[model samples]
Target: MGLWLPNLEYLNLGSNQLVGSFPMSISNASRLRVLNMSHNYISGSIPDTLGNLRNLEMLNLEANNLTSSGMGFLSSLTNYPALELLSFGDNELISGELPGSLGNLSSTLQIFFAARCNIRGSIPDSVGELINLVSLDLSANNLSGDIPRSLEQLRYLEYFNVSFNRLDGKILDGWSFGNWKNIANLDFSGNNFSGAMPDRICDLNSGLRYLGLNDNQLEGALPLSLINCTDLVILNVAKNRLSDTFPHWLGALPKLRVLVLSSNRFHGSIQDSIATSFFTKLQMLDLSSNAFTGLLPTNFFHNLKALSEVVEYEYDNYRYSVNVTIRGLELPFTITVAIPVFTCIDLSNNGFHGEIPEAVGELSMLLALNLSHNSLTGPIPTSFGDLAALESLDLSFNKLSGSIPSQLTSLTFLEVLRFQNNNLVGHIPRGKQFETFENKSYAGNLDLCGFPLSKECSNGEGSETEKHDQVNGKGMAFIWKVVLMGYGSGLVFGISMAYVVFTTGRPWWLVRMIERDLKEKIRSWIPKKKRN
Candidate 1:
C-alpha cells in the first residue's frame, strides 16, 4: 500500500472518532494538498515529519489532542511552501509557548485558527510576516502581554480576535487598521486592555459590522467619530470604565442593532430627540448599572421597530454573542437557528421613575425585560399582555402600585416573574404563567391579597355587606352614647340652677333695700318748672 495513494490530493476524516498521534506515514503522500482530521480524539505530539508534505495547501487538525513537547514541530511547518490555511484550535492539551516559527508560514497562508490551545506566554511579533493572512483567532487562552504591534504588517487581515485571554495594555493605535477596508468582524473582549481607546478606530475603512471591546478598563466619553460607521451592527462596550452620557446620537446609524453600555458610567435619560432615530434595527438595549434617570422617553419603545417585529438572522458558523443580565444572572446571548430570536430591554438599578411605559408592551418579540431597583411608580401596565413572547420579567424594588394586571396572565411563555419589594396590591392574576409564580413574586406588598399571599378576600356580596353592617353598628353605638351623655349633663345643670335660687331666700332684707332706693331717687328728682 506504500505507493497506492501517493498522489492523494485531499484526505478528510473529519468528525470521526479517530485517535492517536500524527501518522508519520502520511509523509509518503508527497503530493497531498489538503488533510483534515479535526473533531477527533487524536492525541500525542504532532510528528515533525508532517512538515515534509511540501505541497500541502491546507492542514486542519483542530479539536484534537496534538500535544507537542517543544517548539520543533511548529518550526517544521515552514516547509509547507504551498500551505494557505492552518487550523489547529480547541486542542485542550496543546500547551506551550507559541513558537516564533509560526510567522514563517508561507505568504500564501490566509487563515489561521489556533484558539483554545492552552498555549502560554506572549504572542511573537514575528506573526507580522503573514502579509496575506485574512483571519486570525487566538482567544480563550492564558496568553498575556500587549498584542504584538508587528501584526500591523498584515494589511490584508480582516477578522482578528484575542478575547477571553489575560492580555493587558492599551489597544494602542496603528495596527495596520488602515489597510483592512474590508474588515467585517473584530473582537477584543474579555481582557485587561486599559486607558483611552484610540479614536482612530472611527477613521478606518467602512465595511465593519461587529466591534467588541467589552470587559476592559477603557475610559473617557464614547468617541463621536463612531457616527461615520453607519454600517455597524453590534457594538459592545460594557464592563468598562467609560464615563459618557447615553450615546443617543448612535441612533442615527441605520443598521445598528445590538448596543450594550452596561456596567459603565453612562448617565442621563434615554432620549427621543429624533422620532425614528438610531435604534431602527436594535434587538437588544442594555443600559443597566448606570445613572440613567427620568421617564424612558415617550417615543422610546415606538422607535425600536426591530423590537416590535420578528427578525431572524443566522450566525452562519460565527458566534455572534452579547452579554445580558436576566433575573440577577449575567448570561451571554447568541443568535442561533434553533431560537433565532432575542429582543431585550434592561434598564435596571437606575433612577428611572413614573409608570412603566405602556408602549413597552408593544415589543411583541421581546424575550426578556428588566426594570428593577428603581423609583418607578404607578400600575404595571395591562398592556404587558402584549409581550406574548416574553420569558422573563423583573420589576422588583420599585414603587409600583395597583393590582397585578390580569392581562399579564396571557403571557404563557413567562418563566421568571419578579415584583418583590414593590407596592403592588390586590389579587395577582391567576392562570398560565401566573400560576407558576411563587409567593415571593408578591411578597412585601401588604395590600396584596390572593392565593399565593396569606391574605384572603371576601368572595360574595353578602359577606362584604356583613362586614360593612358590623362596622356601621359599632359607629352608631358610639354616636348614641355621646348623645345620652349630653342630655344627662343638661338635666343636672337645670337642677343646680333651681337649687341656687331656693337656697338664697332673704325676702325681708330684699324688700327693705328696694324701698330705700326708691325713696332716695324720688326725693332727689325735681321738674324744672317747680324749681322756677
Candidate 2:
C-alpha cells in the first residue's frame, strides 16, 4: 500500500473492518511518522521492517488479531529516535516476556502500552531508563514479581497500571516514591501485592487523582499523608487487609468523588460529618463488608451534595469505575460524575445499627443504595420516595420495622427492590415499579402481606374480599346453617365452609339435618332464662 505513497507521513486506518496480515509494503514510507491501525482485524506479526521509518513518532496497533512470539519488533523500532508513543495492547496472540532491551527504545517515548498481550515474567528494571514516560500500561497479563524500585525514576510518569496480573511482594516497601511527582493515575489492583503500605508513597506530587490498590494483600491503616493530595478524586483500596477506622479526614479533599474501602478489616464507627462541606462532592461511597459499627451517619448523608445534584465536571472523560453488588452479584459500573447517572452508596454487610437517616433520601439522584446485612432498625423513611433516580434498593437483613412507605411507588426508575428479612409489616406497596417486584423482595418479612406474597392482609374488603369465591347453594339454607352453628363463630369461617360444600356438592342427609335441626340445635346450645 506504501508503493503509491512513499512520502506518506500520516496513516490512521483504525476502527475499520480491515482484515488480512499487516501490510509489509508500508515500510516503504520511510517518512511515515504517525501510524495507527487499531481496532481492526489485522493478523500476523508486526514486521521489523517498519522500523526503517526513522522519522516515525507514534505507532499504535491495538485491538487486532496480530500474533507475535516475542516483542522483537519493539527492538527494531528503537532505531526511530523520535518515537514517542507505542501501543500494541489487546493482542492476545503476543506472548512471552518483555525483553530487557525494551529500555533501549528512544528516550522521547512518552507512552507505552502492552496490555492484555499474554506477557509473562517480571517487569525489567531497565524500564526505569524511559525518563520521558508519561503513561505505561502493562495490565491484564501473566506478569509476576514485585514492582521494581527503579520505576521511581519515571519522575514524569502520569498514568501507570499493572492490574490483573500475578504480581506479588510488598509494593516497593520502604522505598520513597517521591520521584513520581507528576503521577496522576496509579492502578495496581487485582494483584497479590502484600505488606503494609508505605506512607512515603503519598509524598508524590499532589496532582495525584486516582489511586487504586484494590484486591491486594496490603495491610495497616490508610496513610494520613493522603490528605495532602487535594486533587485526589478516586481512591480504591478495597479487598485488602487494611485495618483502620474510617478515614474521615478524606472528606477534606474537595475533588474526591469515589472512595471504596470495602472488604477490609476496617473497624469502629463512622462518626458524623464534622463540617458541612465534608464529602460534599463525593458521588460513590462503598464501605461494605467491614467491621464498622454505630448508627447510619445521618450528618454524613446530609453532606453528600453531589449525590443529589446533576454535576458536570470539566474532566468528563476521566470516568472512574467500581464494582457494586446488586442482588448478590458483583458487577462493574463506570461512574462519571459529569453524567447524572450511576451515583451509588453501599454500606452493606457491616455492624451498623440504628435507624437509617432521613437525610439519606436527600440524595434524589442516587441510582443504587445497598444498606443490607446490618443491624439497622426503625421504619424506612418515607422520604425515600424522593429518590427519583433510584434503580436498585436493598435494605434486607436489617431489623427495620413498620409498614413500607407507600410513597416509594413514586419511584419510576425503581427496578430491583430487596426488603427481605426485615421486620416490615402491612400490605406491600403496589402499583408502578412496586408491582414489578416479586415475593422474594419481601421475603422473610412474615408480617408483610399482599400481591406477590401468598399471605393476604387482614381487614381486606371490596376487591380484596371479592377475590374469594361467592357463596353458592340455597342462600336461605346457608343463612340458617350459619345461625344454627352459633353466630359468634363469625361469618368468615362459615362462608368458607359453605363455599367448600357448594363447590364439592352438598350431601342431602347433612343438608336435611341442617334444615331440620336448625331450630333444635340453636335451642340445645342456648341456656334457659336465668333461674330466679
Candidate 3:
C-alpha cells in the first residue's frame, strides 16, 4: 500500500512529538524529493533504505534524538543526485568519527549544518569534495586538527564558522586561502591558530565583510594588506599575541565600524603624524590591555564624523557587543533590542600620558570611554559634559589634578564615574548625579572635601558669608570654593529670604526699631539734655 504513493515528493512530519525510531518504510516513496522529520523524539539508527530515494533533494532530521552507532547513514545520504540542503544539527548523535564517505555527497550540496553534533576526530579531508557548498557550519564539535588544504578548492563557499573547537594551525600560508575570493563571513575564533597572519590575506577576498579570528595565539604585526579589504565591517582579532602599533592604516577602509584588538601585546603610541585618513564610521574601538602611550589621537577622533552627528546607527538586524553591567552582573551586551546605542573607546591599562583630550567630547554618540591606568595629568576635560550619551567614564589611577569639573554634573545619563586615585583637589562637584556617587568615587584624592566624605570645611564659608570668611593663606587655611553640600543651598537662601521680608514688609522693621531704642537710651544717660 505504501508503494501506491511511490511518486510522493514531500513528507514533512516535523515537531509532531512523534515517538520511536524513524520508520524505514518512508523510503517506499521511491521518488520522494523532500524528507523532514526534525524536532521529534525519533531515535535509533537511520536505515540504509533511505539511500533508495534517489531523487531526494532536501533532508532535515535536526533537533531529534537521532543516535546511531552505525556509520553508513551519513554516507547513505550521499546517494541522492539532487540533494542540496542537509541539516542534522542539534541532535544527540552517537560518538564516532565522521565518516569519510561524506566526501561522496553530490556536488550540488550547498548548505551542510552538523553543529552541536557529538562528532569526534579530525574533519574528513573528503569534505572538500562538496565543491559547490556555500555555508558549512560544523561548530560546537570536538573536531580538531588543521583544516585540509583541499578545502581551498571550495571556490563558491561564502560562510564558514568552525568556532568553539580545538582546531589548530595557521589559517593561511598552507591552504590555498588565496582561492577563497568569494568568501564573505569567515569565523575561525575559539581555536589555536598561531604564526604571523599572512601578508597577502587581502588577496583572498576583496569583498569580505566579517572576519573573526579572536581567542587564538596569533602573533606579529597586523598585515598591511588588511586595510585593502575596503568592504570589511567587523574585524575581531582579540585575545591573541598580536604585537604592533595601532593600525591607523585601518582607517583607509571606508566601511569599517567595529575593530577589537583587545588583550594583546600591541605596543607603541597610537597617534601617527602623517596618517590623514579617519575611521569615520567606527563605533566600537577597543585597544585595552596593550602598551599604548602618548596622548590620544585627537586629530583622528575629530574625524569620527558618524560620532559627531545626532543619535543614529545602522544596527538593525546586526548586533554590537561590549562589556557592560547586565542586572548588576558584568556581562557582554549582546541584546538585539531596537536600541542603537553602542559606542566605546577603551584605552585603559596602557602607558598613555597627557590630559584627557577635549576632542573626545566630540563623540556625541559615545556610550563608554575608559582612559584609566595611565599617567594622564591636567584637569578633567570640561568638554566631557557635551557627551549626552555617555554612560561610563573611567579616569582613575592618573596624575590628574585640579577640581572635578562641575560641568560633569550635567551628564544625566552617566551611571559609572571612577575618579579614584587621582590628584584632583578642591571640593567635589555637588548636585544631581554627583550626589548619587559615594565616597569611593572620589577616594585617594585627599584634597577633595565634600558631603560624601567625612571631612568638612571651617565655619563661616557659606555662600552668604563669603566676604567675612576670607583669611591669610599662611595664617589660616583659606577656603576658596564654598561647599554647597554640607552647609546647604536652601539654608543660605532661607536666611536671605528672611532679610528681604523683615526689611520691606513693615515700616518699623528690626533695623529701624533698634536704631530708635539706642537713641532713647543715650538721651536718658544725658539727663541735662533731656530736661532742656
lDDT to native, each model: 0.70, 0.75, 0.68
lDDT of 2 at 182: 72
User: Looking at candidate 3, what is the lDDT of residue 24?
Assistant: 73
lDDT of 3 at 242: 94
Number of the candidate with higher TM-score, 2 or 3: 2
- Residues 1-532, model 3: lDDT tens digits: 1344787988777667988887877878888877777678988777778888888777777778888764567777776787876777667675567667664474778777777777778888788889888768787788898887778888777667787688888875655466678776677888888898767657755667667888889999998889778778778888889989888889878877778888899988887774555788776777877888888767878877666665354543322222222211133443111233356777788899977778887777776788888899987776676777666788888899876666666676677778899997766656666777788888999877767889874442233123321220121222222111110010001111221232244211222212333445434322231110
User: How far is 362's C-alpha from truth in model 1 (Å)?
Assistant: 0.9
Arrange candidates by TM-score, highest first: which order?
Answer: 2, 1, 3
TM-score of every candidate relative to the true structure: 0.81, 0.83, 0.74
Q: Largest TM-score belongs to which candidate?
A: 2
Give a tens-digit lDDT track for model 2, residues 453-479. Answer: 898787763233223212211111111
The 10 consecutive residues of candidate 3 with the worst lDDT sum are 485-494
* lDDT for each residue of candidate 1 in 1-532, tens digit (9 for 90 to 100): 1333787977877668987667778878888887877778888888778887888877877778778765566678875677877778777777778777654474777777778888789988767788888777788888899988888677776677788899998885555366667566678899999988767665764666678899999999988878878777778898999998888888888777778898898888776477565576887788888898898775878888777765554432222444445534344443311223246788898899888778897887787899999999987776787776777799999999866766676676676778999987666656765776688877888877777777776465234433543442222111111001110000001111221122234211112212333434324321121100
Residue 54's lDDT within candidate 3 is 82
TM-score of 2: 0.83
